[model samples]
Target: MADVKKVATRQSYGEALVELGAEHDDFVVLDADLAAATQTGKFKAAYPDRFFDAGIAESNMVGIAAGIATTGRVAFASTFAMFAAGRAFEQVRNSIGYPHLNVKIGATHAGISVGEDGATHQCNEDIALMRTIPGMTVIVPCDDVEAKAAVRAAYEMEGPVYMRFGRLAVPVVNDADSFEFEIGKGILMREGADVTIVACGLMVQASLEAAEALAAKGISAEVIDMHTIKPLDEDIILESAKKTGRVLTVEEHSVIGGLGDAVCAVLAEKNPVPVKKLGVNDVFGESGPAVDLLHKYGLDAEGVERAVEELLA
Candidate 1:
């Protein structure tokens, strides 16, 4: 696995923006002085005329993007997740989300994977905040392939799309040539009948590795990438839970209002099953190395495998 190719989803978002810029001229990008870190600098470099720098005001940047959509032009507001979803929550909910504008929010460096940036910059609550906005579509792609496709899909669709991109380089688990991405649709990565393991973002690859470990122990775990958080694919969760009898939800976020809670909500309504949530234990992140932080927070493959064994026991 060390030889496997890895790419950060934030990089994918930047590359995808450049590709989209070449194909369409109706969309403009706005950044809040973090264009380089957010990877929107690529789009800025390519289409300088179409890029807007709103200084350090993320709220104003979102508002500008919303204003751009009024003229029938799509706008992508790029910034770190903490600012885009946290600091700009009022503007995002009122300016973009309330009006249901065609604004695509590119939230990069999301989750605890933000590493040494610590709790203030590491956003584990963005998904919950974004989902609360009416008609806002939340997407957390698993790898480079899905991240690029998700960005393209958000552009083609008509509505406010909140996309979360990671700072950590994750394994390219999906085959670019064979993979297909759809908004609000979950992908069934590996099938099994014992227990279903659902994950998103960097956690998706960790879930896959956990599945393999479970298989070695004769646990037959099913793996799913719930890329789209809002308008979640309830049918897939019900179907997998029906077959597996149990489910586990994993994420690089807080357990309060992320992937785990979203999946549990569906199962509680449609089908009742035992669910083990593998994520941050309702706590803030500390400054540390990215890989070491994930291990400490129990968001890695070994942590996931251990959670599954405990759930089964």
Candidate 2:
């Protein structure tokens, strides 16, 4: 056990926005009426003048963010994943992606881990939706440390970015000061020869735990945090798949058009291998505890271990 502290990525996003605001005067934030839930309220409190509450109109908010970006400001639009990536998708695609504006979509409450909010609130297709845009960059940070780093990187990186965040309080897997975050680069957490587990968002911690359990059963599992979903790390996936001979992708999103499909696409072209994907499996989430939903949907540590065992069998 790493004695890791737990924190929601949304909390880290708010804190990071405040820090980035201090560092860059051109940084501006926009929210579509869910500031507190999205944790953009913290940024609004610190820099009230720089924050814009678009009042429930997600499409308008995204358009406003794009307009701000044209004025040479880095606009961070915060809202729930469903609304930001779903309700306002057209605006995001045309206003932000089409123009290639420097707008960061802070999409929180993503995946089945969104808990009691249920299917309407949970978004399992944001990555699939965002990655379709030509110049859009999709990032799903594993923990608070990575979320903060991802926010800073999104600000620095030009063009539109959709960074997914979950509501569940996940274990902090990386040291804040020590971990280095780079766009489109994958981090190989555990090295093994038997199999490889590639994951993103909260599943990274679960995959790490599953790796530890697999180790006890004489099943050596390599764990890689494929944090940047878009621009999938082909080299790392190819290298690991070549060494391990098998790959298992775990995510909180749908099995279709997400991390699993992304990794399989890379492997199918470069180094084809037997791969199994664990995710929501084309179902809508219901109201329940976040942890319970994870277990029910097979996105938890135990579920991952079972998937790996089956893959090796």
Candidate 3:
């Protein structure tokens, strides 16, 4: 196997948009002035006529996307996670979610991995916000490969979708040929019986590393990449929980309303088990290097391993 390249999921989203633009003429893109930063500039370059820069008005940008969707077009609105999910939330809820339009919100720079941008830029509640919207689909891709696949999936699916990516680069975890990207399905990256680690976005990589470390310590840890947040793959989660008897959910976002809560909600109803969540503990992030912040927040491989060890202990 070739060494996986490290690239930001946002970069993959941009490349995927260009490819999607070439494939579907009805696929239009809109960015709220942060084109280069959000990676929507690539789409603008590829399909200038189909792309629209909606200035800094994220609310208006989402409204414009909703309007465009009415014309039978799949509009992908791109912007920073903070503005897209927080600032323009009302517009997204009323204009887009209310109508159940075919609008895909490409929210990049999500979670603490945004780095150095401080708490304002780091969106820890995007998943929670999007999940609240009725009939809305939410996805947080693990790496560049999964991000591209998710972009394509969002375009193909109907109704409203919120796809989140981070500014920091993560290693590609999936192979193009073998990996099958499904909208609401969870991918079992590594199988084990002692415990299962369910993770999304950047945390999936850390979970995988933790699984390997655990295995060396004679602890068989299963790893599941739960890319999709809403309409979560309940079957896989329950199956894993039943098999392992213990579960751990990890994410780059807050442990409050992210993958952890979602997993617990299912397990609590279906099959009760001990579930530990590894993520930001309802605290705001500060300016620091991306990797440093991840480590400090206990979201890295070592952090995950320690969490798992303590959970099992």
Candidate 4:
């Protein structure tokens, strides 16, 4: 077996978009004046004419992308997660979600991974915002391979989609040949009966590490990469909860209205368990290193292990 290389989800989006643009002329790339920073510049370099820079006007950019989608184009609008979901939220809701446009919103720099850029740039609520919109497909890929697959999947699926990515380089859990990607399906990384750790985005890496740490201490922790937030994998979650009798959700977003809440809503309605959530506990982030911010907000692997211990206790 060959050693698998780990790639960041942001890089995956950049590489995948270029390939998609090359294959389909209908696939257009739009950026809100931050193409270079968001990594969409890769696509711009390949397909210059098909790329549109909206010059800081995220709202108008989303509207333009939605309009383009209506004209039989798969518009992929790229910007910071905060601006994409927070600034142009209304435009996305009305123009994209309302009309059910085939628009792919690739929002990068999500979570505190923006590091020294501070809270204003970090989007901890992007998932919650996108999930609330009607007819919106929300996804957070666990690694670079998954992110590329997600981009391809988003282009094929019809409807408004928001794909969130972070700024940091995370460990690649899944490789291109490891498994196939499916929308609304949960990937079970490790199986156990003591507890289930359902995580997304950067937290998926943390959760997997925590699961390994827990196993060293005689606790069997099942880890699930619940990448898709909207149209969540309910069956997998319910089954995990029923088998483990305990569940802990970890995310880079806030504990409220994010992946944790989404999992809780499903488990509560079906099979309720001792569910604990590890994330930003209702607070904004500060200017610092990405790993420091994660620790400060109690979202690191140690934090996840602590949450799992508490749930088991």
Candidate 5:
């Protein structure tokens, strides 16, 4: 596991923004004094004229991004997940979402992986909160390749977008040369028959590892990377559930409004199946190492393997 090359999705986001900035000049970036943390600093440095630091006020940053978007320019507002999704919910929902503006929110340091930042910075409910707003496209990239692709896809699309990037350096799962990304689509990481493991963000790599572990245990566990939460790819989920008969959702965020609930909602209406959730169980995160937090909160590969085993039992 340690041998695999790892890169934080936030870092990928920054590099992707810089690439986009070089290609286009109609887009602008706004940060809530968290350019370095959110990885928008790369874009800021490359395109200083297009980048605007809105100080530490996340809400004000959203308002400014919305205003900029109204002027027919694509606005990418960046901040920690806690501030971008939680603190600026009202402004985002009212000013951007209500009007359906072309604004992309780059939310970094999401979930328990925020580590030493503790519960205050670890945003477990950001996905749930963002899911509530109408026409909000929520995306959680799994690896560096996926994260970079997601950023570019969000920029090409219209309306408001909420993208979550992790602070922890995760394993590179996808082959960069062949990988393709699309909004509201889920990627099949592994094919199996006994059970299905649906995941997003860093959890996708964990789920893939868990699937391999399950394979050794004589359990065929399929792995699906549900990168886009809102407008979820229900077709892929239903197909997997119909084939496996059991579905398990894994995420680094809360078990509440994250990937689990989104999958459950789809299955409940279209294809009902026995489902299990592996994530932070409505609890707060503490200051610790990023890897330790994932293990402690049961968001690691071992935890995912255990969940799959229990689900099949």
Candidate 6:
């Protein structure tokens, strides 16, 4: 069990891949020209022979990963979330998802956290895109510990997996040995009845902060880390919605069809409530610090708190 200190989820994925590669030779690493940025360079250094640098061609890289998976090799393709889900959609859909191949797509620089590079680099639509693909397992770890666990889990699991991570260092929320990662289970971070805050990725930290703010004002907000967006712990979400009359969905992605939409869909069919979505709001991000961009796009802790307040009112 490692310490539960603050660390970026991307770093956890990079470090875990190296450990997994050292243990399993069949575990191969692939990168689409952004090895260093995506942190797959660590695995490349550890296992040079098993690492393949596809060099800027994300689509080709996805196809190669799918090909490798068919050969009984567990292939992990690392790239920015935008390219992995958006640019390599068809390859992932036909080559990987359709076949239900054991291909782990570790998409770093996900959401508005890949700030300074602007909206082009940020992947606000990755969840919606990846979740639409059949047999695809979409996961966004809440912290570094969960990130490491998700990486190991994805490697052992059989199917096309999309594990999303961010570029910036986030507050570590999960204890290394305290919680175990489950494919379709939603972890309850904090419990309340005033409202439920369902969040993923870096926004999990924001959701925690919002819960704390709401607590100060006597508004108890239940915080559920909805890491697996595809399977989506619908039971937990519905239960929370039933307890709380209002629900708030938070993510670093777009509000259109991402985490917010997925939660809304479940709530609409199961337990509908006054759900408020906090995210990019259909606007493109600009070049700035990751934290600044989060604030600008209304995905930060302050924004989440405001949304909760609005819904409560």
User: Which pairs, if any, clash in model 2?
Assistant: none
**What is candidate 5's lDDT per residue for 1-313, written digit by digit as tens?**
7899999999999999999998999999999888888889999888899999999899999999999999999999999999999998999999999999999999999999999999999999999999999999999999999999999999999999999999999999999999999999899989999998999999999988888887888999899999999989999999999999999999888899888999999999999999998888988899999899889888899999999888888
Candidate 4 residue-wise lDDT, 1-313, digit = tens: 0154556678788889998887898889999888877889999999999999999899999999988998998999999999999999999999999989999999999998889999899888889999999989999998888898999999999888999987888777776686798899999989999999999987888888888899999999999999899889999999989999999999999888999999999989999888898888889988999888888888888999999998888
Off by over 4 Å in 1: none
Candidate 2 similarity to native, TM-score = 0.99
The clash count of every prediction, one per candidate, is 0, 0, 0, 0, 0, 0
Q: Measured by C-alpha RMSD in angstroms, how accurate is candidate 1?
A: 0.7
In candidate 2 the C-alpha lDDT for residue 305 amounts to: 98
What residue pairs clash in candidate 4, if any at all? none
Q: Rate residue 13 of model 3 by lDDT.
A: 92
lDDT: worst 10-residue window of model 5: 208-217
Report the C-alpha lDDT of model 6 over 1-313, residue by residue, as the tens digit: 1243667788889999988877888879999999888888898898899999999899999999999999999999999999999999999999999999999999999888888888798878899899899889999998888999999998888888999998988888887778788998999999998989999988888888888888999989999999999888899998889988889899888888888999999988887788898888887778899878888778888999999999888
Clashes of 2: 0
The collision pairs in model 1 are none
All candidates: TM-score: 0.99, 0.99, 0.98, 0.97, 0.99, 0.97
User: What TM-score does model 4 achieve against the real structure?
Assistant: 0.97
lDDT by residue (tens digit), candidate 1, 1-313: 5788999999999999999999999999999999999899999999999999999999999989999999999999999999999999999999998889999999999988899999899999999898889899999999999999999999999999999999999899889899999998899999998999999999889989988988998999999999999989999999999999999999988898888999999999889999999888889999999999999988999999999898888
Q: Which stretches of candidate 2 lie over 4 Å from their true place?
A: 1-3
Residue range with the least summed lDDT across 10 consecutive positions in model 4? 1-10
- C-alpha local distance difference test of each model: 0.94, 0.94, 0.93, 0.90, 0.93, 0.89
Look at candidate 2 and tell me the lDDT of residue 132: 92
lDDT of 3 by residue, 32-100 (tens): 999999888998888899989999899999999999999998999999999999999999999999989
